[model samples]
Target: MEISRKNRRLIHTIVFLVLPLTAFILFVGFPLYWIFITAFKPESEISSRNVSYWPREFTFANFGEAWKNAGFSIYFKNSLVMTLIGIVLILVVSIMTGYVLARYKFKGKSIVYLILLCTQFIPGAMLLTPMFIMFSRFHLLNNVVALALINTTFQIPFNSILMSGFISGIDYGIEEAAQIDGCSRVGAIVRVILPLLKPGMVTVAAYGFIACWNEFLFAFMFTTKQASYTLSVGLKSLIGEYAMNYGQLAAGAVMAVIPVTILFINMQKHLIAGIGAGAVKG
Candidate 1:
């Protein structure tokens, strides 16, 4: 009877938890595994009918080809610059906006919140034409700065709400203490509040980086110049109308995944903390 009961419990655990988790892992991990393996495979093997689970021949040639021949070098640089600039702009604007919403009581505060909330529901595609016209009028077409700015604009609404949650989670007494110690409002924020906000800021930055790095439509439509193409656009360009280089395409994808992967791995702890704190208080 004891052994039978133990067996039933084990079965229940497997069915309820282990099996589901394993399935989820396989579902998410298989594509990434395939991409990694395909990236190393030679072109001949890649296009071959034989479905090998592993690469028949490993080579770095694909990465080299993608970087040099496919112009991923330029794309990589542009993505890095644009993502960094966009993150900075996002952090600044989100922090300030968040602080105001969290700490201040002002006229039209509810309306402002409603407007910010509504902006989140607006699709980026809807604004593309008008944005294109505006950028054209401003002579900012094919510009990395302009790309960063647009990305920042799209990202700020949610980030501001998130930032407000984080700011609200922080104790007001801390800022008051800083002020009592001869720190002005700006100085208190600069020295005390900002340092305390690091985890939240990191969370915001990670979100901004991912959004800016993966943005395809804006980067594609706004920049016609090959020299101005970002990694997302550059990857799209690899799809030749008639024939595509699967090997180089896979290689470019792997390259694009690296920075964001590293970032999440490093910032995972802070991300979880920030999210938990925000959820509790927001």
Candidate 2:
């Protein structure tokens, strides 16, 4: 009788979870599965009326062709360059700005922070026209640097806010002690404060990296040169009017997702912890 009750409870739990699980598979999982299947299949299989979840044959040729033909080589390099520049800009600026906001108190500080936070409420799409005009004036319209700059600018608010919380959570006692020991204020921060903020740094760096990597709107609008194009733009052009080669497009997308997947796999632990650190510390 006890065993029967336990089995029934287990069944109830499974039934309750299964609906959402099935929904996820039908929606998110099925599409991703199709992308994977299509990436490996030949063009003939894709055009056939009968579509199966599994591929009849597999080939790496599609990936090789996509890699070479899609101009992703140029896009890949541009993306890397943009990602690095954007990350550096975000980290340096956000760290300094966050430290100031968290450590110092002065007149108008609250108002300043409020203003900064309010900027986040503005729709990014609304600013697109203004940004385009500004970049055009500066002759930055077709450059990867323009994309990196725009992405970093947009990302700064949230990074600074997160860092403020992280900085506040840290006790100032350690920095004070170091300063009392004959270290300068700058030295104390460098030696004592920044080291303890690794988790927050890691989190923000990951955010900056991912934002720059996959950003499409600004990248598409800003860069027109094939040499300057980011991966997202390059991938879209793969599906031209004359040919809707789903296999090659899927293969290109798979290639695009690989770097981000590897990055998350490596840093997911710290990313999760760092998210809570900011909220709890401040």
For candidate 1, write residues 1-282 as lDDT tens digits.
356988999999999999999999999999999999999999999999997799878899999999998899999999999999999999999999999999999999999888887786789999999999999999999899999999999888778888988888899999999999999999998888899898789899998998899999999999899899999999898885468999999999999999988988998886666557544433
Please name the candidate that would achieve the greatest TM-score relative to the true structure.
Answer: 1
- lDDT top scorer: 1
Reference-based lDDT, residue 211, model 2? 85
TM-scores of all models? Answer: 0.93, 0.90
- Mark the 10 consecutive residues where model 2 has the least summed lDDT: 273-282
Residue range 1-282, candidate 2, lDDT tens digits: 256988888888788887778887799878778888899999888889998679898878788877777677778898999999999999988888889889999899988778777777788788898999999899998787778888888888878978777788899999999999999988988899899988778889998999899998888888878878888988877766477778778898988898998889899986777557544432
Off by over 4 Å in 1: 1-3, 272-282
Shift in Å, residue 1, candidate 1: 10
Show how many residue pairs clash in every candidate, following the order shown.
0, 1
Cα-based lDDT at residue 46, candidate 1:
94
RMSD of 1: 2.3
lDDT of candidate model 2 versus the reference: 0.84
